[model samples]
Target: MEKRKFLVVVDPSHERHLALERMLDIVTQRRESIANFHLLVGFEGADKADPNAPSEVIRGKQWFDELMAPVDATGVDYTVEFFWTANWRKSITDAAERFECDTIMLCESSAEHKRGITDSKWDLVRQARCDVVIVDEGTEAPIKTILAAVNTQAKDAGHQALNDRILERGKFLAEYFNADYHVVNAYTDSENFPDRQKISRMSGLPREKIYRDMGKPEDVIAATAERIGADMVIIGISPRTGLSAKFASHTTEKVMEKITVDVVALN
Candidate 1:
């Protein structure tokens, strides 16, 4: 069997360390399925002030070494990499592509009071080609429940594909933790939306566990997660404009900012 490869962004100053630890725990729990772990760090590009690029690479090496010393002791197949680029979103996507990573894991930074979902985090979610897990402050306790938020009234095929991705990822997590898995669909009009059975078939969710509620998508998903005591919620993310564009508050951003539990935003 092929081992799963995880591309994890390790930032020492931010709360991203929690995401690194969470990924390590998941690898330890499912060693047979996870094959390799690759750690990546992006640094400032060399400028007139700091013309030496190798210096940054060496510094990044030192940083990653100290961060992953414990994991090395555990004898996992892992590699460390450094990319000196001003564009973080591009650098991360490039690293994932180079390593053929199965999942790209990122630590979501603390959201600004008025602005939700930092620019860097949101950019990566939009640019990355593979599935991205935007981890919030994670919990030490085992995950007991997971909620897969989907859009049954998707206007196009791309949106439906994202919903499928979210459900598939959610199912994998639920089985991995042996936890309860539930699917939620919040639509504006139930008359035109697919029924519970159709959603189950499309999302691979059990008919009994599928929930069709009425309200705003983000609000309904957040409420369902709270009511079910969900430890994690998986939701699909849509691509936005380029990084240069102004940050627009989208549904995924609202959901991530409002949800209390860990959120996995599938790209």
Candidate 2:
């Protein structure tokens, strides 16, 4: 089997450590066969403004070491990488590409809207070619359930492909954490709406775990997550503009604003 590689971005916040620690817990629990975790910390140019400042790379190493001290790194191989750059969004995506990471995980920065209407968190969702798992800083509970918001009425092939990817990844996560996997499809009216049963079978989940409702996708997804206390919601995302962009934004970005759990966005 090909090795699974995860790129974990670490910021200065304790939340960053939390995200990495949670991921380690899941990996340990699942006993993932062959995996490599790459921890990355990017220092803006300002942080390295002093030519004599202790090396950012060295500092990054010390920080990651402390973070991993309590973590049990038994099965997977792990590495720490650091870069000095001002464009963090670009740097993160670049590192993922260079390392060929299967997924990129990071703690959700409260600065989600710092860059006006274009936040780095959402930008990563749009730009990253791989799966992006944004861990809410406030989430500390062991994951017990995962909700996958599927757009069954999606007209485009891209969206359909993404939906499949979402379910696939969701199932893997559920198995890893021994969590319940639920599928939700929010539709408008009933005509030509997605069949919850079909999605249930496709996801290989028990029929009773499937849910279909008529309403806005974001509201329905948020409600379901709250009802079930979903530890994570796996959804699809893409870089888009105009009307398509609005749909993409509503599905994942808007939902993120309403929920407190982690989100795994498959691109």
Candidate 3:
């Protein structure tokens, strides 16, 4: 199998390099499966400034070099690049495309209570072409349990494909880390409760590992994740626009607010 490439977005303002730490942990554990990493340091509102002319850029490079000393000692093949753009979401997505990365790993920066419409982190989640892992800064390394939240009652082809994608990514991570894997499905009413057998077949997990409840998606997901002591939650997110985007919050965003674990969002 070909090695998987990762685009790790670094925040210069954050005192803790959580995203880079998470990526390093993954590389340490799964060195054989990982390809070279590309680190993108984001400098928002610096689009007009020349890359080499700014004193901030020079200071940022010095800080970045010191931060990368440990990475260099590990002998992991990696490269660092900086981006100065007002449109952070576009810069991240474009870099992902340019590098042909399989996944984008970044720290969660939105407010814990609610994510505003202007939150670029959530926008990055919606805009990125590859799988995006939003790592909570407080999350511990070496994930112990993974909860794959799925909407098994959806009959449409698009949702079905998304459900399958969620399971595939979740199961891959579970096996890779040798962690416990569980599936959670929430239903709105009796008529639409998820089929246990279908979920079992789709997830390839036993009956005992499946969690089914009748409630709102965010509530069920948050409660189940808390109950299971999940270290990470893998959920699917569909891009929204226009009125839908303005009036409502995505289930993924709501779940992020309610839970403290890391989230892997598949588009």
lDDT of 1: 0.73
The TM-score between candidate 1 and the true structure equals 0.81
Instruction: Give each model a TM-score.
Output: 0.81, 0.82, 0.88
Q: Candidate 3's C-alpha lDDT?
A: 0.81
- For model 2, residues 1-267, the per-residue Cα lDDT tens digits are 245688888765333455677667656655454477788865545466667544433454566667777554464677778676768778999889988898898776533342122466677787888888887754555778899988877777877887788888888878767788999888978795887677877799887888787887778888998888788888777536799787767666777766677888777
On the 0 to 100 scale, the lDDT of residue 258 in model 2 is 69
lDDT of 1 by residue, 210-267 (tens): 8878888789888898888888888876534555223423767888888866777777
Task: For residues 102-196, write the lDDT of model 3, one tens digit per residue.
Answer: 98998776323233223778788877789898887546778889999998777778778989999998998898777899999998899987899
Best by lDDT: 3
Q: In candidate 2, how many Å is residue 127 off?
A: 1.2
Model 2: clashing residue pairs?
none
lDDT (CA) for every model shown?
0.73, 0.74, 0.81
The residue pairs found clashing in candidate 3 are none
The 10-residue segment with the lowest total lDDT in model 3: 109-118
